[model samples]
Target: MRIMAFDYGTKRIGVAVTDPLQIIATGLDTVHPLQIIDFLKRYMQTEQVERFVVGEPKQMDNTPSQSAMHVKGFVNLLKKTFPAIPVEMMDERFTSKMASATIAQSGMGKKARQNKELVDNISAVILLQSWMDRKIY
Candidate 1:
């Protein structure tokens, strides 16, 4: 079964998917918040997703961040829409920063590094990879 990951945001949601063997996580795309469910519906037609890993925003003090409320609402909707697929929340602290650093290290040009979509996509990859690593070892 394939596992999917989402980095949810008010403006954009980052998407990632694992291979059939569930070994590697790869960034899929960045979609608008309003279109996320529809996007998933279309994607699910072709891919068999067993579970969803959603990034949960948390403050350094272990409290939910302001953005966490939005993520929670989204998660609720996801559960309502896709009851069969389990949804798991993973801490997303520092993922954006890590994505920025990764982009900087990549060979992409300055303009590409500044793209919010790229950051979101990379952040989704980081979120999924973190979950996979935890699950594996």
Candidate 2:
């Protein structure tokens, strides 16, 4: 089954999706918090997403940060928007750092690292891939 993943930020949300077999995850796009609900409403209608895996932000000490509250709110929005799909949260402590390292290793220009949306999108892909790797047998 296909799964949708989200990296929720204060201003923008990164999105990713797994294939129907849940083997590979791909970065989709980053949307403004204000537009996320509408965007997902349309996306879910077209894409065959069976579930949602939202990244749960926590500090290096494993303490929940204030950002987690915003993520919870977004999770509520996802539940209201796609009531049929089950939503789960996976710890996203180091996704941003991992994404940055991945991008730098790819030899992307510094300008790309400055792009919050791009970074967040790749972070979402990492988050989804981690979730799939951990949860899939």
Candidate 3:
């Protein structure tokens, strides 16, 4: 089974997944907020998801960011819809900026770097990788 991560935003939700061995995280896709459940349902039909990691937006003061309020419903829905799968939250500060910098350093053209969907997808990947890096043993 693989672990999945979500970088949730009001308009779009980014998706990423780790391999069954949980060594590497890969960008999966970006889907509309309303479609996340359906998307996961379809994805789970083919892939066995072991757990979910969600990006929790935070402010400089270490308090929950305004966007965190918006993510509550999405988190609730995930737990409700997939009761068996566990959910985790990881700090997501600067992930978008990191993804942008990664895209820039990748030699991607300006137009491709400007794609919000791609940014979101990469942000999810970064979030998942960061979480994995924090794991012990």
TM-scores for all candidates: the values are 0.97, 0.95, 0.97
lDDT of 2 by residue, 1-137 (tens): 68989999989999999988889999999999999888888886777889899999898899998898999888998888778999999999889988988888899988887888989999999999999899866
Off by over 4 Å in 2: none
Query: For model 3, what is the alpha-carbon lDDT of residue 24?
Result: 97
What's the distance in Å from true for residue 77, model 3?
Answer: 0.4
Where does candidate 1 stray beyond 4 Å? none
Backbone clashes in candidate 3 total 0
In terms of TM-score, which candidate is stronger, 1 or 2?
1
Model 1 C-alpha lDDT per residue in residues 57-121, reported as the tens digit of each score: 99999999999999999999999999999999999999999998898888787887889999999
TM-score of 3: 0.97
> Each candidate: how many clashes?
0, 0, 0
lDDT of each: 0.95, 0.91, 0.95
The alpha-carbon root-mean-square deviation between model 3 and the true structure, to one decimal in Å, is 0.9
